[model samples]
Target: MDTSAPVRILTVCTGNICRSPVAERLLQAGLDQAVPGGFEVASAGTRAMVGEPMQPISADIVRTFGGSPDHFAARQLTPNILRGVDLVLTMTSGHRGEVLQLDASLLKRTFTIREFARMLDVLDQRAADGVAEAGAAVVPSTADAHDGASPLAANAAYWRGLPARAAGVRHLSLPADSSENDIVDPYRRDPGVYRQMEDQLAPAIVSILRHARLNAPSAEAAAGPGS
Candidate 1:
């Protein structure tokens, strides 16, 4: 697990003014509470929505969730932005393609927000299987006595085995039912639709927060009571 720097996340959409900004704010609020300075979340649009404030309907929905949308403004997605981010989480599949086209290297790091959440779910399962295997094979106090291997070495072996077990998961592709999990675009839609979108986004943001906690090395370390 890399703990070298803060996790930089960029959320994207067709126009930053609406869906992307709302998703950004939701993610920011969750991260501010859960991870603090350990991660960053920002949003942009594939087309130019630069300098625009979030739509009034989106703002209302944000307010209902007790979040202030003041800090976010629309911006255009650019190669530089995608290049700088550790994760590019887009609002839709089309938005995902746009970010990848900007930089193909981003394919490894980019995912639709819900898509990444699902990947995190897969990773969590892998980690659990690792812990269980370690517990079963290595008697904690005796691991260092039988072999010349240190307890740390035994632990490293367990960790090393995880990636191979998780190789079967398709990280880049979301299932066909992903639409039910996605934050439906509310651009030019009624305020009711905006509210519905916010509802979908808020839960996905929470799931992403949980996933980051489970995976981020810095987050795991800071999780200690006095740290």
Candidate 2:
């Protein structure tokens, strides 16, 4: 059997009631099914409504995606919150700036969610294009060898190394418009904006979950300790 600490992920937005919470709940739900006990996801805002529940529209989106919106309260981002997180997904590049401002050490681990998704897509594409045997080849690390390891161990190593691997291929996939990398906030906005929020955020979430489920090693790889 493989035993390792769960990977921690944090999502960020402005008010915390909108984008980040939806991302947090949906990611947590999907990862529960995808990797099960392998990840933890949470959210906070830079200027959080700090105790407010998720906005109704955003809550709807979460439910639509098979996630829960009950019992959520907004929180402000802090260095303490950033501690021990393996990945940080922000709603906008500006939010990304704020996160890095709080903790520069997370520079490699933090990314605009859309940008991160695209980077992962690029890496996934590279593996398909046969540019590398595996996307991990882009970073050339001696770590993360999957041979005879439990599926959980393999999954952990692959994902822990993912930020660097994704970062390596990012330049190849820049959006034509920089704003394309951000999910528009829908706090107190009209229906169109809510649609825009879902339009932008859902695909990124889908892409992330897709990558996780696809890349997670199969059960056959769980060779157990001392195999």
Give each model a TM-score: 0.71, 0.91
The per-model lDDT (C-alpha) reads 0.64, 0.86
Candidate 1 C-alpha lDDT tens digits along 1-227: 44334557788888788777777777777666654555567888899578888888878766776667896668888888876576677888888888888899876666677766665566567657764423434432212222443333333333233233333355433577857546687888777887788777776776666754554333223233343
Q: List the residue pairs that clash in candidate 1.
A: none
Which runs of model 1 end up more than 4 angstroms from their true locations?
Answer: 1-4, 125-168, 171-182, 215-227
Error of model 1, residue 132, in angstroms: 7.2
1-227 in candidate 2: lDDT tens per residue?
23356778999999999999999999999988988888889999999998999999999999998999999999999999999888999999999999999999999999999999998888777767767633555432223344566566666677778898888888887999999999998888887898899999999999999888867666655554455
lDDT of predicted model 2: 0.86
Largest lDDT belongs to which candidate?
Answer: 2
Which ten-residue region of model 2 has the weakest summed lDDT?
138-147
Q: Model 2: clashing residue pairs?
A: none
